[model samples]
Target: MSLANIFDTAASAMSANTVRLNTTASNLANAESAASSIDETYRARHPVFAAVRQQVEALSFDTLDAGQTETQGVQVLGIVESDAPLQQRYEPDHPLANEEGYVFYPNVNAVEEMTNMISSSKAYQMNVEVMNSAKTMMQRLLTLGQ
Candidate 1:
């Protein structure tokens, strides 16, 4: 891989991590939300990621080295709602309670969401560090001519 590709890779990672953090935050925010029906309740959302690949010309003049594949970075496929069951509680007096005296809560797990948040944050920080390191390396390379 070329040195310049480092920036693109890191940038893509940072973007993917940002999406993960946002989804985690949203899950946490709706963790306590209540709904009158299971269909209306919020579901824990998660982002799916996929590896992005690119075809590059081989560095050699040989015909066998014509096309090579390299991973560019990560791409978010889409956000998916968790299949976990929603929380149902008997709260007869609650305003949002259904006729059956039950309230439906989102399936979000606070602890899991918190863990995801932390992981995403750490990943983002790591990407930032990678970018900084790449920048420093590029600067040092500039001085190699002198």
Candidate 2:
């Protein structure tokens, strides 16, 4: 890989982390949400990430010499809802309760979501630091001739 590609890699990682954080926030926001039925209840959402790779070719005397591999970065495959069972509570007096006196709550766990948020934030910060370090290195390289 090249020094310039570091920025792209870090940027992609930051974007992926942003998606993760957004999904975690969404899950947390709906953690306490109630629904009349299990099907209607909001489920915790998670982002899936995939790595992208690029093939690089080296040339010698205008002829292809060898191949090299480069990582482009991470991509969000998709957001998936958790399959865990929803919370079922019996509340006959609740207005949204079903005919059977039951209410469904999302399967989101606050502690898990909070941990995900923290990890995502930390990963994003690390990516930012990487980008800044790359910039500093590039600047230093520019001063080498002086």
Candidate 3:
């Protein structure tokens, strides 16, 4: 509703996008990693964001009190691992292969991860733009007063 709220929302989005990009990078880096067992395999990770609400309403002269207020920012609840099945490679000649001639690969999808990284990076940049625009507008308002 206010300029401050827009800034807050953009900042929170940028933070969440940062986490997304970091996790995507990690997943892409381990996409080709080979593991002897499923336990050692890497799983794709993602962050969960939750909306925060105002607990108490502030008293004001003109503005009426709203019982529930939705904040413009979000908080990361936690990171979750992908539960998809692991990749099974038939590498009988490979030394790391198990007795059954099977090697376990990580569940990371390199292409998907790369795409996610790009999207997150763009989202972060967009948020930066939002912040810059807000700052410029505020500066222009100061000039109006002068």
lDDT of 2 by residue, 29-138 (tens): 88888899877889999999999887665444566666464659999999998889989999989888999999999999899999999999999999999999999999
The 10 consecutive residues of candidate 3 with the worst lDDT sum are 52-61
Taken over the whole model, the C-alpha lDDT of each candidate is: 0.91, 0.90, 0.83
Candidate 2 pairs with clashing backbones: none
Between prediction 1 and prediction 2, the one with superior lDDT is 1
Ranking the candidates on TM-score from highest down gives: 1, 2, 3
1-146, model 1: which lDDT tens digit per residue? 76778898999999999999999999998999999998899999999999998876555556555666464999999999999999999999999999999999999989889999999999999999999999999999999999
Tens digit per residue, CA lDDT, model 3, 86-130: 999999998779889999998888878888888989999999999
On the 0 to 100 scale, the lDDT of residue 49 in model 1 is 100
Number of backbone-clashing residue pairs for each candidate, in the order shown = 0, 0, 0
User: Each model's RMSD to truth, in Å?
Assistant: 3.3, 2.9, 3.1
Give the local distance difference test score of model 3.
0.83
Model 1 whole-model lDDT (C-alpha atoms): 0.91
